[model samples]
Target: MLDDTLKTQLKSYLERVTQPFEIVASLNDSESAREMQTLLQDIAAMSDMITLKTDGQDARKPSFSLQRTGTEMSLRFAAIPLGHEFTSLVLALLWVGGHPPKVEPEVIEQIQSLDGDYNFEVYMSLSCHNCPDVVQALSLMAVNNPRVRTVIIDGALYQDEVNAREIMAVPTVYLNGAEFGAGRMNVEEIVAKLDTGAAARDAVKLSAKAPYEVLIVGGGPAGAAAAVYAARKGIRTGVAAERFGGQVNDTLAIENYISVLETDGPKFAAALEAHVKAYDVDIMNLQRADQLVPATHEGGLIEVKLANGGVLKSKTVILSTGARWRNVNVPGEQEYKNKGVAYCPHCDGPLFKGKRVAVIGGGNSGVEAAIDLAGIVAHVTLLEFGDALRADAVLVNKLRSLPNVEIHTSAQTTELTGADGKLNGLNYVDRVSNEAHRIELEGVFVQIGLVPNTEWLKGVVELSKHGEIIVDARGQTSVPGVFAAGDVTTVPFKQIVIAAGDGAKAALGAFDHLMRMPA
Candidate 1:
């Protein structure tokens, strides 16, 4: 805990930094023992402030404080700032310094009507750039409605808390004692949740439902392309997506995708979505389709049931649901995802340009990212849990020939280490020698493989042994009026151009099928 004199100094420093035109008062305790309590109270009084109290076994109670006054803010971390936590503190201070603009009055009133103290805490890692928008939206509700207090916790800083909550991804928001929302959330949806009294049961019953002619599931490059092509063909197409851009949106860049020389994932996704919207496509964001039931007495009609209980019926269905990256499931892997660990090499590799990067897995994607990064990054440490690289001979040769690339055969990642909130490096154990060595790296990319997004399909469609949707040459699935394309299907390459072409083929197949049906 901070002493009275130190607390006063902190307050003074904050005031000086923020330069709040409004008169600021510093409340300090005369006694050293009472200082910590006073500081906590002072922080609680501020409009937007966070006070972190740390009581580790070895060290004295360290109280880190941050406060915002107008345009400026001050950060004080009592613990020895190291690893991801240090980076988290810097970002927290930056967030305080740039307080979001006041929300609209109607929105404020809607949030304020809720009775009782509702505490919403969102746990996220800094690597998720999409999370800040959600945090800002929640903060607006907190500022307007005093009863609703929203806290954004850096997942890395609160690893134990994240583990207790069983957080599997970034940008997971918890309302009160239960999970409220995850990923990115718009302001309107959040306001609706708060207005419903924070009752998950009640909230679930109040969402809206709609039907579509052509319901496209997934939001990856393939899905987006399908939506665009279908909409342009004068078909009433609607996209039901868990996320706007799926796996492609999480990428750093797509240089191999022709025409676009080099582009980031989020930016490319935004462009793709915008292009789809330019037509008449209805994009239902953040909606996950859980089940697909064949419509009774229908000419190739399907009813898609969403996880949110909303039902969408369509004459045709296009499943472009892409795959998810596989993880090692080792200790600290989940805690360090997006902190020092990442899944997409193209997305995060540039961030470590001219620095060392570790690529996990012996597969094609792992070897490819490693070879790609070797050209730009200073050094590439490729760790393959197996004795040999599982990629194609050409890729393996390319990787081996790179001067900066080091292949670690039969090496397993044991631990991830970092200082502040950024990745510092990782430790690996050699299976052959049973010896361990740590390498300093700016990033680690996990490219073991991908699990197809076909779990929900179950009995709805025919899938290959690898779980990939089995589709005909014309992009038609076993089920009539339902088509599968891109990486989700058993197609050859997982490139963006191939996905786009697959999307086009699916749309044409659906159009031909729709034309043959009687009115």
Candidate 2:
């Protein structure tokens, strides 16, 4: 099933496999089963240490398991692991065949030491960029600990299973028949969830760390850039992030990140992390800062308190906590999230295929979502609070040209209506006519905009009316030795390139401030 170039690459990757492994597929007479068999054959043909067997009796047809020879270590895929999941399949093969993963030693040890039986089933879409992370993470755990078993299922291929579980989101994970999580999660995050004592241990370790010269309170593009710049200055630097990549992880196509022609969010975010890691920056992932405590005396350390009871102190702090999706805050919006209301069109769009859906907002994101969904869904109803669309002319034109898209300007979403834990429709009002309206749909995609992640700093820092941190030209905030940048700051445009530049400027500003301080 793979092209010649892909075959060559797969062969090269499989050469790293040191131990014997086998692909045991459970097949049927369906075309997908044949395709899966071809894929397995191509993969098995790459390495002499790898073997293929089609005699397995799995309940799910077109499914396969990568099993290490003479061991219970195995990972299963219930669908063709192509598209975004192809890399996940390759990683599973290598890891299952005794090829070491590029994870930290401590993380590997933690995975190995996990005591409980973890039967993880992940429902993911092939188009979802975030799915691979979850699949790979669980695959890593499964490869390390025999007690942990991960089964990756393609949601599009297994629509019956998805519907039965009422799964409306990609990368929805179920642990032992219960909903575990329903979004992008990394290995550390998953481990923390499984290991109850991990938070206290992490908090203790974080609190004991020495104060840094520059401490970045985010891990998006801004925080990464700041870390690189600070580390280049040969000063102590640390980064604390709720989740590395921030809002960018939910982003799909990023065509305007200069020099690079085109790339997705996950790849770009991974690159950012790798670049920051190349330096001596101490990165604390899955760490959410809840409060900022400024120094009482000049040249004193600024303290950033984490939600996990961890406190990190620094001489100069850069606030780049980034932003999150702005919810409509209407009734049932939160309650129906993942039930039918989704924020990411790219991730959840497939789940609504052949079903009527609504897009909230008339900006570029909303219009783009409508345009994209028109092809996959039965119909897209776009509601805008303004009289006119705020999207680019090209996007507006494209959206208008689509037959399946319906646009409603001056429409305010008042409530999302649903029953039995599933959304059925949404209620809106027309400002022009003052008439209330309701549209029946299976899914609602909120694409209004982002809200800065500055709620924690509401009373701590000087904020704009919109809750963004007020910063000067040098990315310096109102407080002395405290700088802010990225989406969390009062930056005009919240672009990746802009955020990175702001971060660098903030890092330089912090360095200059530190130079003038008394030792």
Candidate 3:
């Protein structure tokens, strides 16, 4: 049964349609095919414009095709359209109804100039805001040229493809049977890759001339705050990050940022980028800093080597590179990821509502997830690798107070078990008893400790035993002209507000150092 909330939204989306299209659904006798067929029928029945036509004569598997009422432009869908993909299916149907995407003239000309037939397959999730932009851009290319065809696949729906391509992220593109990069990308960048190949994507090189006074090496809240503060001082500033949003892009909800009631990761990240861009901060996104070359002489600029073959020089550098989630690399973990295995409880917990789920690792994050899931899920199981829980006593008491909560200490997760292309259960073992156990659950949240992204800075900067860069009170690193901030630094708490404050302090410290320099 479909959730009433989703049903209401789907109906509302279908009602606002400006045109009509036909949805030709075909099915086989297989179980998966039948299930997919039923899902399509249920959706098609919602609107008069949506038509379901079953073709058993030529049907090989559970598949459906979408074509305009009078046009030959048809797109094929070979999986069940559910979860975050529901949005993608909704948008695709609207586009089939004569709603052409807007495109730039230069992009159109580039697409029109292509000679050979090319099919651009974009793997995406409905929850990903970045996916819509790439999908729309490629859809424009496919519509503008007859030789080009683009298809957007929900990465969660096609489990086999996800396992085959090793797709760990959303909005991953596969060009002509080759794996392209992941992350949010612009239309011009995609076209550049398509026209001249991967080499063309890295054609824009960073210049070392006219070094900025302050350069922030991250794109999260910390880097954004730093850039804003530096730019406000009327000093040249630059922001370089592997991705503009950093770990904030992976988060779902934020309620404790001060003054903000509620906001999601993508929304907050967009606002941060917009705020930084409001100033004269030079944004060099999609660039990873590989090595940092400290300035040798006074007033001389430091050079930052990039992973994609470029060098950016700045008078002072602020390192705010954020931390990434430590994934539990057990069997079926990657295969069932985004299927039943998830890392961020905030981002994906709502998807598993009313279902039983488990939390791995007995840290503060696991206890918090158990408490949060207990309210939405049918049951919650907390598993810990240690003999005793590492969470605070208050959290332990609160968690024990929950009626549906269960805790297993010294439990080591062995494998994630799944069937029918979805996770169904989990297998683990007890360290003390030397016994094995299995639990029927739909979701697993890995909440192990976060690992700092400071391996690249080893030997270049002084680091703690855990690979975190050691920073003083003023955010100054062992290297004089370099500074560190955010989770990447020696900060105790890894909060958005804390990172923002650290970034601001780093920027001010850089400016202060610049002021004492002999001009």
Candidate 4:
């Protein structure tokens, strides 16, 4: 029998180790087993860093074996792996092995070159299956490089941390101190920022005193288009954005946009940014607009305040601020989001081919999701708590025509169910009938309406009841010298082509305002 002194010493040693470890019990006697179980439970309760398992069938075993690796450490349990527990055994082996298969060697080198200690934490829910590849890639990078440490924090497990970080979506990677990258990024692209130390810098630098003909906020389709048009017109233009692509980076495909029959959002945004960069347009990234006020000199110039405590003077301002997705405030919704529950149908639809899925919300996004998923998934159940869909006639017709789509009006989701630590189905109730039903689905896509990203512009510009900026045909806001465009503005459609065209109009309007300025 193991003495209390020996158990106490083992517990003390285990507590000091930072590496991930699994505990395996092999004691034969009932008293010894109880003590070992208690010790394991105490350790697990202390931190999420440790895993525990018990093995009590073998009485002949006198000793246990322990193996250590880079990622996981394993201890042999005197029991057979069977039934549901067999998977756990496999997981223990995999965890202890530390090696998670193989990835591209170039990807490894790219991650290894990154200087300084980087705690790259990716917040993801278990439901987002597609996110695993991205997480795995990041994990592989961490394995290859000592300076970089990758961790996948369950969004549900750490609610307070998620709230503090303002994580709205899954697969959100926080680098070092601030929010670094979002969505899925390839290894090469991630390395590019590290290689140049551009992303690692404090912030994008801009000349404080230099006067510009036009200053554009945001860098999505609208903002990028405005920058290109203004630069071509020989106007000294500058664009400041938190991120270059804005909301367009979240998009998966662009079939409706003109001149581009088929294109990915990132690729399109990259091309637009490149075209603008080819000219003399100055692009400042990772800069947030704090405020806008009248300039000292009259004639339509404005003073733009930045989050970095910097100021810029501009002849005119074009606000191409876009819209953000509405979130489902359900339990485990945030945790499993990006895992099985997603916001953008276009971004994640193709990934769930021949899978059973459900779409929440009855608005335009809801109808769009139903139509999109009907073509891809084996079956799609559109759940709307409203009486009817609020989409345009064209979209409504498309959604109704899909045979694989099933519309459930006045339906509300109560809970999400999962198995094997992954999303499996959902429990929903009918609003009118008060009847509840369980659905077995591989994915749940939230198609709720978008919220305009105009909270920052409150009191600065005239906004509609829905918070959309009120802009004229030329993308000129009610306030002279201040222009708005894209979905954030009073645009009829939130299409890429429409946003691009509106951006052009906003830039032209700014240029006109600039030309009339007093020299």
lDDT of 2 at 277: 93
Q: Looking at candidate 3, what is the lDDT of residue 408?
A: 98
Candidate 3's TM-score: 0.70
TM-score of every candidate: 0.61, 0.99, 0.70, 0.60
lDDT for 162 in candidate 3 is: 65
Which one wins on TM-score? 2
Compose the digit string of candidate 1's lDDT tens values, residues 332-390.
Answer: 67666766577756434544557788899888888998988897689999999999999
> How would the candidate models be sorted by lDDT, starting from the highest?
2, 3, 4, 1
lDDT of each: 0.68, 0.93, 0.78, 0.69
Lowest summed lDDT across 10 adjacent residues in model 3 is found at 196-205
Evaluation by lDDT, superior candidate among 2 and 4: 2
Residue 299, candidate 1: Cα error in Å is 1.5
| Tens-digit lDDT string for candidate 2 (382-498) | 999999999999999999999998999999899999998999999999999999999999999999898998888888789999999999999999899999989998889999999
Cα deviation at 456, candidate 1, in Å, is 1.4
- The residue ranges of model 4 lying beyond 4 angstroms of the native Cα positions read 1-182, 185-204, 207-209, 328-336, 345-356, 362-379, 389-405, 412-431, 434-443
Candidate closest to the true structure, highest lDDT: 2
Preferred candidate (lDDT higher): 3 or 4: 3
- Model 1 has an lDDT value of 0.68
Misplaced by over 4 Å in model 3 are 1-148, 153-204, 329-342, 345-358, 367-381, 387-406, 413-444
Question: How well is each residue in 199-260 modelled by candidate 4, as lDDT tens digits?
Answer: 33333345345878888999988998899988989988999887777777766567887677
As for candidate 2, its clashing pairs are none
